[model samples]
Target: TKKALIIGSGIAGIAAAIRLAVKGFDVEVFEGNSYPGGKLSEIQLGEYRFDAGPSLFTLPEQVDAVFQLAGKEPKEYFAYDKLDVTCQYFWEDGTSLKAYADLNRFAKEVQSKLGEAELSIHEALRQSAFIYNSLAPLFMNRSLHRFDTWTNPLALKSYLRMGKLGIFSTMNEANQKQFTHPKLIQLFNRYATYNGSNPYETPATLNIIPHLEFNIGAFFPKKGMHDITQSLFKLSEELGVNYHFGQKVERVLVEAGVAKGIRAKGEDHYADLVVNNMDMVNAYKTILKDQRQPKLLLKQAKSSSALIFYWGVKRDFPELDLHNIFFSDNYPLEFEHIFKRGTIYEDPTIYLNITSTHKNDDAPAGCMNWFTMINVPNNQGQDWDQMIAEAKRNIIHKLNRILKTDVESLIEVEEILDPRTIESKTSSAQGALYGNSSNNKFAAFLRHANYSSSIKNLYFCGGSVHPGGGIPLCLLSAKIMTEMVEG
Candidate 1:
């Protein structure tokens, strides 16, 4: 059997290992951390348990497909419940909206609360579905670098309808034209942050995001978001994929322009093929330093990072759900601070995820685990210590004002994850949650291809590479990358 070596035990890496093992390869995964899941790991704060990263779960069928590919039932290993209310959105102006999972109910809610026309909400979602259905085949499910992808009948059909797919306008522009209410526009525009892009600048093609939540449905793992990684990790091991935890890879051993294997922990392990699930930028700079670099792709602006405060609140708020958003008073100005100014805004939009809403034991009785986060610029030699301090003050003040309580007093436990810590822990380039910003239309095409063009038996998967970021895309990245492999 051919031997396959994978670097990193991230969700994508684990998925790739399972696929390779099922293909009859001897797969081994090397992880720098002692644990699996990378950012999808969990943290214990006193009596509270919080999912460390990637709280939102969507496109669960992708995860199911992994188990199905391995001839196992996904439900036997993992389970999730579709949320009736996807998210609760709150604005500083005393306005609130519950984003119901049912599209018709949600549209009616928008009409009732925001005073927006129900037809407008329906039309916006219709556009989102159109974009997703049209482009997902060519851009998402297949490798864009391959000529066959562009020449496929479905791809050709999608290209013909590109203009109508919202490629030319920005996400904000598309939302502005679709809805009359500014709050409605803001709610829709927030989808850009799903991939860590600025809605005001990212191509309107990203409007396809809303369809995933409101249309298909939002889901939470029965155990918590960390269960996503734990379940997959279990599946991979059951498939005979070996894991070497805390063994950091030092270099990708290349000879005469072909990847042979990897060197880690002062030892060399050879494999028939090497798959990289690490951040594309960091991987190139460190392990593949001597190899030819895709400088242009590496230089493209990075997606936004986050400053997360894992707060173990002493009490629960019924108004909040598994997912909640607190809108900034000045949305555009906040983006300017994050993307252009490279600073956190005083009034930044906040995302508060409370897993205890569904998984009661995640917190103590009458308590909640608040995974509070704000989008901030990627690391660029900024004073994060000071920034974190100031940002916390701002966040507490905003939460107190909106929730009508002293949020600062409710915290019984607290932990912070900033860009610096994210970079150190996950090895994401500059702590970017996603690989690259889709601020420009060409970003999808510009993402690193699944397979190395120059090096034989080398492949890339995960958020930093083709397709894009988030758990679903990262899993899709693995599927796309591994399809090129031949046993």
Candidate 2:
């Protein structure tokens, strides 16, 4: 059996370990963090449990497939129920809408609240489904760089429909053109943020995101989101995958232009293959030191980082749902503040994820765990301490205005995660959450490849590579790498 050495124990690393082990390969995962899950981890503050990263859980099938491939019943290891209400939205104009899981209910909500054209909304949704269906087999869930896809009849048919799939126009532009209402456009436009891209600039192809959540479904784990890591780690270990904790790799060992293994903690361990779940920027700069750096790969734009305030509130709000968003006065201006101006605005919108509504243990009895986050500019040498302090005051004031309560006094415990800390903890370059920003339409084709054309046996995964970030794409990265290696 071939031996594989993986750097970083992110979700994709664990998935890769499981897949490789199922293929009868000897697998070892080396992680910088003592625990697995990387950014998708958790922290305890007194009695409160805070999901450290990625508050939302969508597309459980990607995770279940991993357990199934390992010859185990998926439900035995992981289970999640579809959400009836996807999210609750609050605009600055005193209008609110609940994004329902059922299309008819959601359409009714949109039509009643925004006075949107139901026919236009329905047609646009059908088009979104069409685009997602056409691109899924070609762009995602497979190796886009492979020559054989060009030859396959199924792939070729998809290739022909690619032009009509709407990848060239911006998401906001398409949604605005599809509907005549401002709030409705704003509602659909919010999907761009799912990948940490600006709706104003990111291509309309990203409209596929709403289809994934609303049309397909969004899920909530029976336990907290971190339970996802706990269960998967248990499954991977049960499959006999060797895991090295708190071992940060300094160099990717390349002997004669081929990957041998990695150098971590002043010790060199050799293996036949290496998979890096570390952020691409750090991996390229640190691990592949002797190799000629891919300047093009290094230069891709980074996604917006976030500033999060995790609070263990002493009071529960009956009006709030599991997921909520409070819009800023100006959506376009807010994006410009993050991406163009590189600063936080006084009127910054806030996203609140209260998981205690679903799982009571996230907070103490009678209280809620509030995962409050706001998209901010990636690290560019700003005064984050001052900025964060000021932003906290603004957030408290804004939430008070919208939710109609004194926001700050209800906390039993609180902690903040900033861009600087996110970068330090996860090695996500500039603290960007989703590798590179999709501000440009060409971003889809520009994401770093899973396996380099130049570097043999050295591959990239997790949030930094194609077909892009978030849980489903990260899982697909593992599947794509396994297939590429096995083939």
Clash totals for all candidate models: 0, 1
lDDT of 2 by residue, 1-487 (tens): 8899999888888888888888877999999888899898998888888889987888888899998888899898877888999999997668999989988888888899888867876788888898888888777887777888667876878778877777778899899889998888887888888888899999888888888887888898887788787788999899899999989899998877788989999999988889999988888788876787778867998999999999999988999998999988788998999989999988887999988899888888888999999999999999999999999999999999998898788987899999999989989999999998888877777788889787688887888888888988999998998888862
TM-scores, each model vs. reference: 0.99, 0.98
Lowest summed lDDT across 10 adjacent residues in model 2 is found at: 159-168
Who wins the TM-score comparison?
Answer: 1
Count backbone clashes in candidate 1.
0
Which one is best on lDDT? Answer: 1
lDDT of 1 by residue, 127-211 (tens): 9999999998888999999889978899889978978998889999988899999988888888999999999999899999999
Model 1 pairs whose backbones collide? none
The list of candidate 2 runs beyond 4 A from truth reads none
Q: Candidate 2, after superposition: displacement of residue 28 in Å? A: 0.9
Worst 10 residues of 1 by lDDT: 159-168
Q: Check candidate 2 and list the clashing pairs.
A: 303-437
